[model samples]
Target chain A: MAKSKTHVSHRQYDDEESGWACMNWFEYMLVVVLASLLLLGALTLTLFWALYYAGGFAWTEEPARQFNLHPVLMVAGFITFSGFSLLLYRICRCCRRIYVKLFHTIFHALAIPCIVVGFIAVLDSHNLADPPIANFYSLHSWMGLVTMGLFALQFVVGFFSFLILLCCEGATAAFRASLVPIHASFGITTFMLAVATCLTGLTEKAFFKLSSKYSEMPEEGIIMNALAMVLVALGILLSYAVRREPFRTQVKTFVTERL
Target chain B: MAKSKTHVSHRQYDDEESGWACMNWFEYMLVVVLASLLLLGALTLTLFWALYYAGGFAWTEEPARQFNLHPVLMVAGFITFSGFSLLLYRICRCCRRIYVKLFHTIFHALAIPCIVVGFIAVLDSHNLADPPIANFYSLHSWMGLVTMGLFALQFVVGFFSFLILLCCEGATAAFRASLVPIHASFGITTFMLAVATCLTGLTEKAFFKLSSKYSEMPEEGIIMNALAMVLVALGILLSYAVRREPFRTQVKTFVTERL
Candidate 1:
């Protein structure tokens, strides 16, 4: 975590170097949008877990309880943490490059454990079921596993390219620059996949658990649908904000003017 | 459809484009990747439909037969067509700007009806059911409606901005240029959502049909999983190819040099 003298702060490229001093309405609104999404996504996911527990949650060799952990951990690791990491560059636009990079790395580092634990929960649920519910049988399981694999791959590549490779003497500026868009594309894609997994997984669970009771869509079903919408909205907003080049280009304009 | 003399061919921008003569291995591979995805995607979807029929398709006011149309039309309209439209800028890199523009516009124009027909199938299935299956109840349904809305909005805005506004004298070159990235972003995002819809929908159907019969891994279940992987792979490849900047930047270099 030691600061290197040669490391230029990303904020140094800001249109103004006064440290978040100049604020625009568009930037403020984007922040508001991201914050609302994170808040709503987390709140709804917690509510879902609460509802599951209220309905009946347990831990002792109970397949249902083990299964319940799947959604909770996934939302925590995959959705929330991943969402934060996606926004880190924008959120920390005023910070030094290394700090932003570290924060982004830390958030993703936290996400992996949660995702692994969630996958384990999924496996445990199937294995523990009385009749042994089949694992990896449905498209949901296939997509979930793929999403996790892509996520882990992204994290490893990103860690090496962005964090480690940058320090190597042989690392050219062009190579570092080239990795940006690829890293970003992978990040956005993986985040969207996580959202997709949540939607599909929830849909599968809803049909299995509530479709019979709420064939006409009782309150619980409605909540699940709403949760999915919030997740989708988050994904859309995150992608839009991430793709905004004007903000980053604005930083370059300042550096040019200063020179 | 009249050709504009002012619009130069995109090929001229190629890193010293004499013609299609400067082909590279990377570009060729990208084309191969895209073609394989499109081929595999269409083939698998047709195979899935065929499997459903082979398993015994019903059309007699039976919700199943009507529901069958949903996947076919969706794959036709949303997945295959939308994906092609997304890649038009890349695939048509050799064409003049206006021609590429028109093709992109026309392809999206064609996708609308297919999507509408697909939605109708969804409605018919729900309505024609004996007790009447509820509509827009599941997370998949919610996401589908939302994706449709976003796609329609993108189409409207793109049609006006790219085609209509460009005809007006007051429209600046900078304005048209700005719309390009936004249009591209929405196009890619919407296409990814369509793929996600296919994945979630297939998961729902497979679980309902095969999970019970082949709870321990049936042949049909494996086919469904394979279909989902193909869809996910297609989404990733499409996004990667679309985000590629070298292909587009090569065009701009020619413009800059001429100016």
Candidate 2:
């Protein structure tokens, strides 16, 4: 009876694995394709909103127009670049683990300048205004601060632990393996925080700029709202992609590569 | 050689399990206490904001004051009750699975009235206003609608699959088991959406009611911002607790219970 029970359990495991395998290809492709589209679409919509509705962007020449760079660049940095970086893990499951890690790091590194300039554009816009707007006073600014801080921390920790520690690979293997989940969790949290901050920022902008017109649902209002919805949709899709166990790469290389 | 390799891997597993067991109690207690406090603290702060700052609540008699009920009750329903319900799975790991499920269902059921009344309070406040404010126009309102829709869908699906299908436990066991992760993932997503909705709503309110005073960081603005921080902290802590593998229960009963 005990032998039969063991056999039954082993078969059950096989059945579950096979079930996951069958659905894996289509679902994987769907998530990758949809996520790619939404990431790029969010950036495109923001650019459109900034250019078409909110005058174009400028540096110190026009602070009002300079403020427009804040949203567009933030969406590009936080949503587009950071998002693709996070998705690289699942998207490049067939690639060498080192190649995937390099791409992830590269993508995030590319986001750094965009975020820094985006931060500066807003501050410059506010300070350069005739009657300077108060900086970091609103909830949106506060949330953005938190998100940026988290992003910086994740980048530093990931760089040190995942890449730098690889020099002493044998000794640090277990440590790196343990940090993977922690790094991944915080990465996703940072992304979600960015999404929330953007939404609040958009709300503030709509109310501040559109004023009573926001309630009237002007073209700009609808466009901004659509942009917000895309962010929301991206939040849902990315989280689902990251959390679903069946989508996780099951390659033996994953264990050997320890990433 | 084969037997030795198998023994080595088995011992590694044992070591990992034992390591988790050592840290489990302290970490578990910390998460439970912290989560409980934040969950209640959020609701309390919102009450203070509504009552002290926003002039408290009323029904249709006083439309403006009645709007106060919307934030307070929404926090109670969406953040407090729904939060505790989600945490019960991890918190009551030693309890019978059936009891935990019953409690989860009961807590969510209690939230139903709070949400419904909260929804109506805002609607009445808008419609009964002297100027008759528009409904579902702002990004906040749109986000709220999405949240409420998701909440309702989750309730129906959870009730039907987890509770009603118990009548044929043997035949439906595999089906129910598969639904567990999906249900769990969506539950967390719904909670996060609720948090995002609340943050956007708070931003809208601060801008709409507080107006220019909000930037000066008045007492009410500080209070509302504090409340937002608490919600953000809860989001981080709850997600960590749920996702941490070491914190997950590993009892033999877990498999037998299939929760």
Q: What lDDT tens digits, residue by residue, belong to model 2 across residues B88-186?
A: 865677787888888999999989999999999999999999999999879888888888898999999999988899999888888888777778778
Worst 10 residues of 1 chain A by lDDT: A250-259
Using Cα atoms, each model's DockQ against the true complex is 0.48, 0.63
Clashing pairs in 2: none
Clashing pairs in 1: none
In angstroms, give how far residue B77 of model 2 lies from its true place.
Answer: 0.8
Q: In terms of lDDT, which candidate is strongest?
A: 2
For residues B81-135, could you state the per-residue lDDT of candidate 1 as single tens digits? Answer: 7777767655455676667777877878888898898788779878888888778
C-alpha root-mean-square deviation, each candidate = 8.8, 3.7
